[model samples]
Every structure is written in C-alpha cells, then in structure tokens.
Target: MSFTFFTPGPAQLYPTFEKHLQTFVSEQLGSISHRSQQYRDLHKFTVDQLRTLLNVPDSHAILFLGSASEAWERILFSCVELESFHLVNGSFSKKFYDCSNALNKYAHLFEKPMGESFVASEIVVPEYAELICTTHNETSSGVQMPVAEIHKLKQRNPGKFIAVDMVSSAPYPELDYSLIDTAFFSVQKAFGLPAGLGVWIVSEKCLQKAESIRNQYSIGAHNDLPTLWKNALNNETPATPNVMGIYLLGKIAEDFNKIGVQTLRKETEHKASLIYKFIEKQPGFSTFVKEKANRSQTVVVTNTEMPSADIIKHIKAKGMVVGSGYGKYKATQLRIANFPATSVEDVEKLIHELGSL
Candidate 1:
C-alpha cells in the first residue's frame, strides 16, 4: 500500500516528483555523458535553480558529492590543517566532529545533551581552530540553532571559516551566505529527493583556503576542493555525478521557485505548529526539545510514553509513516518531518491519527 512518508531524510517525495521522474526517463536524461555540453547545461540549470531557491550568493560555488556525510570529511580534509571546532547537540553534529577526529584533525567540541541547543554567547571557540562547524538543525534531536546565532559566531571569530551542516534544513534556514564560509545538505532531506547527492556550497574564501593548504595536507585527489572547484567553475564535477538526481533537483527547485520559497516557509511553520500543538496536548507524548524557540521546524521529535515501534506501527496501519528515534532514543521517541514536500493537509491527517492513538 502506498503511504505518505513523514520520515526524516528519505521522507515524502516532492509533489511533482513522479511527473518529473517520468519526463526525465522518457527523455533519457540519465544516459547523457557527464563530460558532454548537454550535461554541463543540465548541471548549470540545477545549480542556478538551487541558488535562486536557496538565495545562495554568486560568490559561493555549489558542488555535488556522495552525501552530506562525505562533505563532512571533505570540508575537514580540504580546509583545516591543524584544528577544527564543532557544536555538537545530537548524532549528526557529533558525527561531523567524529569525522574531523577520524581525519586526524584536532577536533574540539562544545557538546550539549541531545535535546539541548547552543547559545552563541556561551560558545568559546579555540583560537587554533581553523573551521567552526555548526548544525543549523539537528535532525536527530529536533533542535535548531538559530541562523542569527551562527552569524554571531562568524562575526565574533572573523578569522575562522564557518561551516554549517544544514543537512535536514536546506532551503529552510534562510541563512545569510555572506556570513558563512561554507554550508552543505543532502537531497534526501528538505529537497525531498531520492538519496545519493550531497550539495556543498563553499565561498570563494573557503576555496582559497583549500588551495593554499592543498599541498600541506592530503586533501584527497579527485574530489578535493581544488579539483571540485575547478570543474564547478565550468558547471561540472571532477568525477561523474548523480545526473538523474541533479535533473530532478533542478526541476523540483524550479517548482519551488515558482511557488515562492517564502510561501513554502510559511507553510512549513504552520504545519510545525500543528504538530507541536498536538504533541503538547497528547497524553502519551511530549516534545523532545523543551524550549520552543530552539525546537526544529523541519524535524519535530517527541518523547513517547509508549514504545515508538508501537506508535509507528499504529500510524503505518493508518496509511502514513513516521520515523523512529535515532540511536539510544529509538524506542522512546518519534521524529516527524515537516519538510516542504509534506503538505499541511497531510500533517493534519497525521495529527488526527496521533490524536486517535
């Protein structure tokens, strides 16, 4: 049976996804050679659509990678020579920090309990840290660090390159590109696309840093920043990329642009409010994150009184699906994605099912 997915990451498909996919297949878009002029046009179209949809600056170059996880390793390897700092509040943020450590970079972290958020004023960035990593929205814990707070960190540490992992909150964070040196997100989350493509947006300054330190560290070979940047200048990639994913992303982004990003954001906020309000009154549930201001508008996590498995099964039977909690909270919590692909009507229906539970 077909079900509307409320799961984070590979959540519900964009409303126009099927139509676009059918057209792409019929047109044989996937068979195009990556090095051909046809492919470069496709590449540029996607990047242009994304820049328009997300308000990305012209100074930033958007490059495609395997996944947001890979971008974590690339950013550390290419940009940092000695030290990096991270604000960790959940699994994903912690994983970015872990990636840095795995890469042999001296990774420093200011960690908070899973459901807590960070305050910019309280963060003490190490002077030796070359790049500062922040997760705009923690998908694992349903906590969001305000974009303003991120801007404050950048302002306070003008010398440090700021990287934001907007993995699950892309096109939603409304970040000021001038403030951040780099940011990334995977297509599966907010873009509502099939998983596989990771979008890394890097500033010219970040590119310069990677070039200066390229010989100093083993910053990879084929997919290194310099290599990626060189090809991206021509609207291409060093290696063959997910052409189908890029096509769908461009089409969907074009759809989003036509609908207007502001309209989508307002709809997302409305839907999030619906779910949070329902959780507030539901007998067997409470929001995982306590502070409303810090709660994520994209991924809403709730502490369930009953096993999350039971709750998930209950909802699945009603023709809908939601995500189980991450890691340790697997059995005790539920995550509901309020991405643009999931409609307000769908959210209302999901709430109705939860209310019935």
Candidate 2:
C-alpha cells in the first residue's frame, strides 16, 4: 500500500527533473557565488525560460527570491510606497494584507468570501494607493481569479502597480503579464520542487521607480529588488542563490520548453477535471468553492459530510494523503493537489478508497 494521493506542496517532481538533480549533485555543485558568472548564467536561463513560457513582456524584469513570501516583503519594502490596496478572498490573501499592515503601509482590502472572485468593480483606485496585490490562484480555497479582468483593472488605472501571487498558477501555462508590475510565485506548487525558490517578474516601470529611489534607502540582504535585478541579468542573485533548486529549475524549463506551456496547461486541466468528476460521484462530498469557473486547476478543495478529522484519519490509514482546509475552513474542507505528476488513475484510486471508507 503506497501512500499515493492528494499530497500538497511540495508537489511530486517529474522523473526527468529527479534524474537531472542526481547528476547535478554527483558533479559536486560548488558554492554559488552571488557575483560569479556560473551562478549568473543559471539565473539568466531561468528568467529567459519564464519569459518565453509565460508569454511575459520583454520589458518585465524577472528576479528570483528565496521564496514567494520574500517577494511579498521585497515588493512591500522596495516597490510600494505610501499605501496599497489588498484584495483578500482566502487565507493567503488575507495574511498578505496583514503583512502589509505589519510593515506600516496602509492597505485597503476588498474583502469577500473564500472562493469568490475579486471583481474589478471593487477597486476604487484611491490617489494615495501606489500598489495593488492579488493572488492569481488561491490554493487553500481552490479558487482562481480571472487574469483578464485583472488586466482590465490595470488598463483602467495606469499609475498603480499590479502585483499577483501566482504561486499555484505557474509551471502550467503562461499568465497574461502585460499590465502587472510584480508577479511572484513559489516553485514548490507548480514546479513540483522543494520550497527554496521564488520567482519574481517585474515590469520595466517597476525598475524605473526602484532606480529613482535607489539612493534614498539602504539595500537589505535579500529584499533589495534593484540590486537583485542587476545580479539576475548577469545570471546571479543578490545573496547566495539556491544552487540545487536553480539547477532543477533549468532542467524543468528545458523539459517545459520541449513539451510547451499550453500543452502542459491542458494536461493540468484534465487532471483537475478527473478529480472533480470523482468527487462528484461521492454521496456526501462536494467542491468547497461553489463556482465552477472559479475553481483552481492545480488544487481541488472539497467538503465531506463526515467530520474532517475522521476523514483525514481514514484517508491516511488507506494510504492516501490530502490537505486539511486552511484557517476557518479547517476540519471542513479537504484539499487535493492535481498538479502535473498527479494522474487520472490516482484520482480514481483515491475515490475508490474514499468510497470504501
């Protein structure tokens, strides 16, 4: 009995990436010098792949952070000034808003239910607000925002910086990055790797702003976006880069380049649909997020008629692993990750086990 289903991030890695990682380790990775050419080359490779795969604009500056949360801090401390607008619809979004307040930056929240979409109408575009943050896909709630609508907001408001948390949305398809100032993600969810890496894509406008204010502030160890960008272009990081993670990212990008992002996106959608269909068959189980269109293609969250603790125990005993819901939804909703490596057969097997339970 292999524990085979519904584990969350770090999602299962592709076999090819694992093989490449083994070779990388055996070769003895030297210390990743932040100023070294070899390290810089790895950074450049990653940025180029992201730009090509995600259909990102050439003007956007992609910077690698230690984690997605680091991107949040960097964006808050470096790019955002005065105040910002925070859109909260799930655990992650809510916490992100709180983080902005903790940093002493004023942030207005467009509060909504966990799985609800943030309609552009909710935005007031105040004069003082310089940045706007939203999560592209909420893994905890299994809800995805409409990327098109977000771009529409950007078009309507030219001055504000649009930052998106795309942690759960990457390694699938390219996002619409035209109007976004800072788009960030942790590689663990989409890339199926460990949690040491963060990808930050910045618009040219953001760079201009950072340069304008460069001399006014002291550069922190990891949060200095301007220095990070300069290093990134040379295939380096401001601090020590994640050597093994970057190596894995290079391998993953090569594989993605060969297969294509659109192709991968379709496969991911298929995986989500398969699991949703299986959950549909269960008598007392239903999707946590009510809207069909808003549900995530990467994570599928559902609620069962039984107690969540009991359900978790039963599922685990049956050699399957699933995530408990986040924050208030904990003990009520179950999260199932359907990223690339998750298969249709795996979904069917989990459903059968649940049916037996």
- Candidate No. with top lDDT: 1
User: Which residue pairs in candidate 2 collide?
Assistant: 39-235, 40-235, 40-236
User: Per-model C-alpha lDDT, please?
Assistant: 0.92, 0.77
lDDT tens readout by residue for model 2, 1-357: 657546568776665776887777786655546576666676677778877777788788777778888787778776666687888888888878887887777888788888787667667777788888888788778888877767878888878888888888776535666677778888787777778988888877787776676576432455587777776666776667778887787778777878888888888888788778877888878888777878888888888888777888988887778888877888888888877666667777777777777
What is the Å distance of residue 325 in model 1 from its true position? 1.1
Model 1 residue 161 distance off true place after TM-score fit, in angstroms: 0.5
* TM-score against native, each model: 0.99, 0.92
Clashes found in each candidate (C-alpha, N, C closer than 3 A): 0, 3
For model 1, residues 84-147, the per-residue Cα lDDT tens digits are 9999999999999999989889999999999999878999999899999999999999999999
Residue pairs in candidate 1 whose N, alpha carbon or C atoms collide under 3 angstroms: none
Q: How close is candidate 1 to the true structure, as a TM-score?
A: 0.99
Q: What is the lDDT of residue 48 in candidate 1?
A: 95
Task: List CA RMSD, all candidates.
Answer: 0.8, 2.1
